[model samples]
Target: MKRNSRLSLALHALSHMAFNTDQPHTSADIAAHAGTNPVVVRRVLGKLREAGLLTSERGHSGGWRLARAPRDITLADVYLALEESLVASPSETEQDMCSVEHALAIRVSTIMNDVEASLIERLSRTTIADVRHAAQ
Candidate 1:
């Protein structure tokens, strides 16, 4: 399944942060590295901040940093923080459909839910530090 780009961006930023935990990383810096805009970086990282995975500071030397240790943050944590689904869920508008279609929709939805659960389960096994180490 194709996943959202925001998850890539978050993981990229976090993996880089894992290597350089001594100081904060600016959105501009991360955006440059990810080949995106600082505003886009802020929007994605903001969600991570809300999830308590990262912290931010303001001022000349201020930027973003991990709130917890890299080993403490799992891939699943970042995935859920972004709140995007890799699997396409069955549409709710299919409620007005016929019995066959409705039944198919229900079955599809159940399967999709299982797929997402399995994805999360797999992601939970890896931490940000694991990702960083893998890159080396």
Candidate 2:
């Protein structure tokens, strides 16, 4: 299954922020670290801030910081904040099916739902704190 790259980038940014709790990181700095566009970093950070997972300030000394402790933020929180959906829509041809294909589609949808639930559950199980700690 293809996962959203934004989710991974968000997690990376969060982990970096969590590990450097004392320092607020600028979007450009985060973008450089994550090797992505600064606008992308800002966009992701904007969503995180709206979700109350992060805090930001303006001015010369302004940047982004974690709003709560790392342990308090789950992967699910970030994922939900980004409004990411793990399931991809089936193609028109896939949706239009024969009797056997219809049955398969039902089974496939059910299995995909279960798989998505499991994946999300696993993501939720780990906190940013966990990632920081594991790196030690």
Candidate 3:
């Protein structure tokens, strides 16, 4: 099971944006730094754009820029932008599964939900600028 890396990629791209240089960072540049393809970079960044965390431009000198200051964009913002499930739960066994199995699954699902909520709360405490500053 390959881990979905959209969350990390979005954060990485946002951190790069915090230190924008001569121009907005292009998808190609970001992909190169990430060691992935531009298409993948675009896919993850697209979500960031949709969430209003970043903005994109198209033209000879067009690229991506932060929609707001990095201080305003929390890690939770990126996580939510990607819309990924932090917890994975297996499907119910068989339709004829015993009551004990059903009960256990319900309890597990409840626990997972709580865990996901806690994760988002923790992420909210940090921002892209925070990470960028720490790196520098």
Off by over 4 Å in 1: 1-4, 92-94
Off by over 4 Å in 3: 1-4, 93-96
| Candidate whose TM-score is highest | 1
Cα-based lDDT at residue 35, candidate 2: 90
Give per-residue CA lDDT, model 2, range 71-119, as digits (tens): 9999988888999787764444755688898777778878888887887
Order by lDDT, highest first: 1, 2, 3
Model 3 worst lDDT run, 10 consecutive residues: 1-10
**Local accuracy by lDDT, each model:** 0.94, 0.87, 0.87
Clashing residue pairs in candidate 1 (N, C-alpha, C atoms within 3 angstroms):
none
* Winner of 1 and 2 under lDDT: 1
> At residue 125, what lDDT does model 3 achieve?
100
TM-score of every model? 0.95, 0.86, 0.91
Question: How big is the RMSD of model 2?
Answer: 2.5
Q: Residue by residue across 28-103, what tens digits does model 3's lDDT show?
A: 9999887789999999999889999988998789999999988999999998989888788758775866888888
Minimal lDDT window, size 10, model 1: 1-10
